[model samples]
Target: MSAEIRLPGLPLVALPGVYTPQDDTRLLLRALEREGVRAGSTVLDLGSGTGALAVAAARYGAQVTAVDIAWPAVLSTRLNAWLCRRRVRVHRGDLATALDGRTFDVLVTNPPYVPAPGSRPARAAARAWDAGRDGRLHIDRICDAAPRALRPGGVLLMVHSALCGTPATLARLTSAGLRATAIDRTAVPLGPVLRSRYAWLRREGLLSPAQETEELVIIRAEQR
Candidate 1:
């Protein structure tokens, strides 16, 4: 089962399963509009939960491919594409594996980035929020793979936690051969649930107490 969500003039269908769109989807949508991603450009969406970004790109007439590791996400993406009457290729696999031998002019992703404590191993879709020990595991992998996935002069847009591992993300992107820079940032208040979870991490020395404030970073990089 899925639900249809209308974002202003944009209509999107969300999966009833584990995958759902996050605020990062809005950030990417705005960035694409600003950067003028349109027809003919090929866009690859990694960790494409619910297919919002892919559908938006397709709506703009761009060729879009939405990839995820979860089968439910793949099904939802396909359903959403059908509802929109657009052709979006949905692949199910881990990271870049589904995109074998394929490249894109624009690559966008919003990966798992929450730094979970060792005691609390993630379960289900919550795993999508856990980024391993440093909260950069998934992000680093994405950055490392972007060079091969993106064409020369192509663009990569990603949203990650600035408080958790922004510096690490920048370093990883640079080391991965992409000239990365933060383009937009927004501070979102940590809900009580997250605050309590983060408090536990702080007490365990996994996160700094000063990290009570969470910042969302939108990074744009170009393959050089």
Candidate 2:
């Protein structure tokens, strides 16, 4: 499976302690574009990280708002937007809490989908990738909040590892009254976080001995 590449030539700033753009971010951006994130659309990017998606959307002429739980991430996103000469509202909050009562034309996220054995991330940069035991902590929360967060005809493009259960995400969105589908997928080698837990993953039957890669899926849900 092929992965999405970064936006060509957009200057980005990486503040220490912020999550940098990666395969997941690129995949979600591709999916978002395919789903029709165009000029004048109001877009929200959760777990905005380096604000790569936000900046990309702004370049496409969309009004964007990016949110991250970490202050450094929020700061980094703002810097990246400035570097790219695009304007994006950056906020510090958990998930959709910062946008309560606001709806968007599109919602995009490259949330922490790495399934870890801990009850919670250790803090700092770890919070950017370590999802709880099932890896659906943020995914589930996003799904639950989607219908309410989206305006009619709005779309949600989210990327996550398939190990976290793609079907669960689809079901949650569908049950919440949206037309949801897994629109794209790609396989990438285990990163340091996943590699570090390789043994535990094998023991938990989440990964196999010969599997050095993890499959990522982009779930697109449209509010109809």
Model 1 lDDT per residue over 1-224, tens place: 66767675556676665545656667777887776887899999888777788888888899998888877778878877887788898888887575688889999888888777675666776766777766777887788888889888999999887746677778888998899998988777774435768767677575566775677899898999
The superposed Cα distance between candidate 1 and the true structure at residue 187, in angstroms, equals 0.6
The C-alpha stretches of model 2 lying farther than 4 A from their native spots are: 1-7
Q: What is the lDDT of candidate 1?
A: 0.79
Question: Whole-model Cα lDDT per candidate?
Answer: 0.79, 0.85
Worst 10 residues of 1 by lDDT: 15-24
Error of 2 at 44 (Å): 0.2
Q: Estimate each model's TM-score.
A: 0.90, 0.94
Residue range 1-224, candidate 2, lDDT tens digits:
21222456666766777777888887887876676777899999888888889988888899999998888888888888887899899989976575689999999988888888957455888888888888888899899999988999998889999999999999999999999999899999989998899999989888988899999999999999
Task: Judge candidate 1 at residue 66 and give its lDDT.
Answer: 88
